[model samples]
Target: MSGERVAVVGVGQTEHRAVRTDVSMVGLIREAAKRALADADMTWTDIDAVVIGKAPDMFEGVVMPELFLADALGAAGKPMLRVHTAGSVGGSTAIVAAGLVQSGVHERVLTVAFEKQSESDAMWALTVPTPFQAPLVAGAGGYFAPIIRAYMQRADAPDDIGMMVAVKDRLNAIRNPYAHLKLPDIDMKTVEESPMLWEPLRYLETCPSSDGACAMVLASERVADAAAKPPAWVQGTAWRSEPTLFARRDQVNPQAGRDCAADVYQQAGITNPRADFDCAEVYVPFSWYEPMWLENLGFAEPGDGWKLTQSGATAFDGDIPWNPSGGVLSSNPIGASGMLRFAEAANQVRGAAGEHQVEGARRALGHAYGGGSQFFAMWVVGADKP
Candidate 1:
């Protein structure tokens, strides 16, 4: 169905961590779904449809997990769809679920995304050998290291930029109780001294292999009107994809990502994102991505993005804060990270983010990308109904 308008009524996330061995995949998603339902002051019976998404089957050694998790998520006998767009699955999942409501087909829907990376090695899972591809790459780090290096060279960014992103996000995690990597003492010095995982990508720059899930409940205008708290109105949402390998794709700043952001901002009537967006929850698995995306998102010039990070513009109290929820840096469950961004944005608009809440925040942005930067998804949500 074509989604014209939608609103997020509830958002929920399990305590993100490296290992959620206490629950299986189905159990993990159900836990989050249950919390979302409760947050809306509704029951599973109230949900009209369900959508589940994750990065890859290899990560959890569970192919077609949603088929097995249907009943567990109370999705039995209902329309259930699964989305796979690499790391962007979570945000894409939410968009699809919201479509069900905006199309006037369903009143309320439940959407979830998860990754139990502990069941298998995520690094190895992502290092699959495609035909004619070189075998020297280790994992995501290996693929992204050269790009980060290029960013450093192209932007003339200082080495401290990475450390700054790491420290700022980690400290922001302190305010977010559900963050996975609770590095209570994370600091720029510690990050600079941390072991180097991949060249130009320090150990602290990499996101942890986490086992976690995130869930959200989308409702129609009528349903949202009855919600327990003010709902985050779905102001604008967009998704874009290009082939995995394309000539002049601009890996550092893909056109798809730029186009996706433009689409969302257009729909939200935002002329300048850096000023219009009160806060943003973007998927930054690596610290350098913060600056790279800043430029891509039009927050700064092509080569001056690092200046914002260095000048503390991206900090919580800064003019245009980004990722006050600690972001993917503090808690990255690959499959769930994108949804976490979208959910965190909703939380900020709803005033649900306790310590990380941007006071009087009226609007926020949630963003994610995946598949060699070919897939992109973004949404703009506002405190007032749009």
Candidate 2:
């Protein structure tokens, strides 16, 4: 590998909500793309390629919708690609776009991801009948409840830890104007008292099924050098996959996630994530995964991550604050969730995150994982050019 450098010149996202019926899928994407182009001081004509990603077609009842969205996205003649990898599609899409630049294929690329769950029920979409598969799980909450309980058992993490995460992220979301679920009055007591959707998962703990889209404009080193302001240089990026439903799979702390983080850290020369990365945006649809992933992502040793969370190490004012943009816990459009994480990290570096911006965020980590803990994607972005 010649180690060609890449950087994010533009980033944009739609305000996540329960339903964005006012605009079609194409409109949602265009809105974000236009914002990104404006930020890059460019336009649709300047984009050299386009890449779109989303979760399964079942969620929107539109199989490979990107095929029909070409004209609207202004990619009629430009190179285009679509990617599907469950919930991590967004982050994975960004990685693919960055690869185009790093591989010397394209100087500019537009990557976008979206999900309009309002068109269909995600619970029903995910529970589609499969031969020999049990029909007990209703949706993601059901599928993940037992796993969360196991974490609480194995790690002996206090129940309040999950509640605290929900409250903190919800509070953080208020500052994020684009967040989907904005609980202004949320607090520890409110989270503790919220109705239980699934055992070990409360209404406050589960991610909201939202309708939104996110987009990013990536450029090569030469293109980045011409940007108006400092670009978020793509220091390192990685993606990994493992078979789902494996007998040996540890849902609580998947090795694929650990390996994925290790790869990006190694490429970026990061030996201590807790100390090196100024801030992070991790995919935590459920609050408990905050601590669980803290351990899995090498930020803390197993059985010790909860201590950090309890100590407020992951809070907004802590040593290495995480999810300063509120994260997937605050706003999740399923398909776009992962990409938003990457975009947010890029936003922090670009000094464009508005109220949720981390102070002097020089180095940041954007991370996402999905599909029964089988897929992982992460990237390290820095203010300084790579």
Clashing pairs in 1: none
Report the lDDT of model 1 for residue 361.
Answer: 90
lDDT of 2 by residue, 141-206 (tens): 788889989999999888888888898788888899999888999988889899988988889988
Per-model TM-score, in order, reads: 0.97, 0.98
lDDT of 1 by residue, 211-278 (tens): 88999999998878877788999998899998766576688878888899888898888888898989
Clashing pairs in 2: 91-339
Q: Say what the RMSD of model 1 is.
A: 1.4
| CA displacement after TM-score superposition, residue 135 of candidate 1 (Å) | 4.9
TM-score attained by model 2: 0.98
* Root-mean-square deviation of Cα positions for candidate 2 versus the true structure, in angstroms: 1.2
